[model samples]
Target: MDKKFAGKKLLVLGSNVGATDIVQYARDNGAYTIVADYYPADRSPAKRIADEQLLVSTADKDALEAFIRERHIDGILAGISEFNLLIAEELSARIGLPFYFTRKQWDMIEKKSDFRALCEKHGVPCPKTYVTGKEIPEDVMQQIRYPVMIKPVDASSSKGVFKCENEDDLRRYYPESLKESECGEIIVEQFVTGDEFTAHYTIANGKVTLASVDNRYPIAMQEGDPTTIPIARIYPCIYLDAYIEQVDAQMRALCAGIGLQNAILFVQGLYDEKTNTFNVFEAGLRSAGEAPYRFIKRVNGINAMHVLVDHALLGKTDFDSDKEDPYMKGKCCGIVSFVTKGGVVGSIEGLEEATAALPDVIEYECRYPVGSETPCGRTLRQLMIRFVMICDNREKMAEDIAYLNSHITILNDRGEDMVFKMKPERIWGIQ
Candidate 1:
């Protein structure tokens, strides 16, 4: 058998769930993979599959550079890790290794203020934003209206994000958002109401080669919940076709303006049905989190993970990029994440049943092993389990999800069924 990445040394940063999948994908392509993470060897599942495991912080650029140098690594790869992306950019630049995004380019997109400015300069549709440093001036605060969103300028995964309903709420949450920022900067933007959608694009040689869109929604958020915790996503966004052409044009223009090349980006936007317009709010110069890699492979018969490795590591672009490509035609797919209450988790039931009974179950995963204590599992960051479901149509999806809701259950040590206190609005539905 011919190994495409034979003898290539690929250094993968951060051994979280996303990094673990990337490591396995690289190894399958014949690359000698090394998993580096802050977590211990026993706790990190990605480490177990790697050819070598190093318990080191990905944020520490010097240590990572030394490890890469000592190993004579040929390439570096990172996904679903915002902090590590910066480290990868710095290390790749220092060692004279080719990288997807330049340090300057990464900085522009990494900071919320810079990204908003770039969007404005390129005529990209985005929410009006006010970038604050240390404090929001009285004059600046006066212009802002109620129901705005305050977010850390350089944070991801909603670390320091809050929705302020009034000036009082802003005063209380402004400092909280600032704390999550390394530079003590935050962006307050007008909160838009619409269905959220994320676009995935693969750029090679300064041109977007592959593109797809998905609808994203927060799960487990209760009524009046201020924080946005996205625990579910549906592929082939039901509303994508309504404005696909316009959004595609905007994405291409944004990439051209940023000079982005040889990378995968997740562009987040809101779709206003009333106006029939898509408003892009933010974008990341990295792969979108979730099981998109597997979804693309199963639906399109294309292994996008392999293409990601080839592009980010080998500077190659030998992959499909047709916009009209047939992937899971006449099918609807979605995923739901299970969040448990904080306590000692005994065991979960109905996973086997879910796979067997669901019309087209694709994958199922559990984070905590039996007898493990779930730490704040009710929080988005501590999701206990997740499973994917595919259906021939939207009706089947709704029916299967209904079945899952009634059948699946998580329990605690005292034999009490853990009920997910999801907000009524967040109940599963096809977006």
Candidate 2:
């Protein structure tokens, strides 16, 4: 069938690789594209692909509204940022353009505490959670089981998320860590241990359409390190078909309870092997970064970027029914994010040779520039590059990952010094 977006103008908020793909897809499908970002120095791959580039703060409501009004933007799509998601929803409402989520729905998903409460009200199984801005009461502490997860109520990419082993860890991390979040409220919940996975979907006319399910194999053995981001995300998750069905039902109920309309949803949860239960951790009203998109596209042969753009431009209501199940032969495709250990990134070596060696490699992009000082911490800042790979054979997947790890290197301050090696098992345990 011919593309649906024939003459729409799309405004992409944020200029990352995901935004680049969206902008490029819009342009390729006969739509005008505008790439906007808050930081002027923030160079985006999309800027090179967009028809026009605008430096406007998404947080600045007036500037955003004026841009939409002056340019007659048909729709607004957010890159994988919570801050930008708010701007996208607001701009869509102000300009009378189709939006992924309404203002109320967006607010519900953005605030962690509120989202947990909503899930509880709807009878969805989420971790036992609470919020605190001060000292944890003795009674509250008694109620909360040990080894709980502590995190800021309104943060993403696992920023400030800590695993508190006991009361001491809680005291050490709270109040101080609370300041890091834009929202002061901190969330304390029971730490659910199991195989963690993410389900990505789109809601249209109150129906939940499953786009893809990603099994997140963390780069780090533990959470909260930037360098420890997902080393590999296998799409069409194996051994979770029944679990996915349960998750889909719960997600639909949660969206309906919050009055969510058209929008993209990224719901994260842990599947416990002991009890065979799926416990939700958190949810976002946006895409799951560029990594998941790569796998989704490879397996299904459907571009998630294009689907998002089409939703924004032509209204999600017009999506074709035949394209509903976008999985590819139940094969697994994965993405591994390359990260820095510490020190300035002097150079990236062996990428071309690595890809040439493994044709299963889909795409790889570096986020940092040469000579930029790499920040310390296990969190997202450590991420320097991203590599996507696709394979139907499970053994070949292992081979592909090993090939990339052996070839990639991150140089430190010393001219001849190479930083820590990227070990998939050390970062994210074998899945």
Best by TM-score: 1
CA lDDT, candidate 2, residue 74: 90
lDDT of 2 by residue, 313-418 (tens): 8775544424555354656566666656667877777877888888787777666777888766666666667677777765667667777778866666576544
TM-score attained by model 2 = 0.84
How well does each candidate superpose onto the true structure, as a TM-score? 0.86, 0.84
Whole-model alpha-carbon lDDT for candidate 2: 0.70
CA deviation > 4 Å runs, candidate 1: 38-43, 55-60, 130-137, 166-172, 323-328, 357-359, 375-378, 421-431
Give lDDT: candidate 1, residue 315: 80
lDDT of 1: 0.74
Candidate 2 regions with alpha-carbon error over 4 angstroms: 1-7, 38-42, 55-60, 130-142, 157-160, 165-174, 177-183, 221-228, 321-327, 368-372, 408-431
**Residue lDDT tens for model 1, 293-398:** 6666666666555555776567875666653242357676767666766678776787678667765778777878669887763366566777676778767766
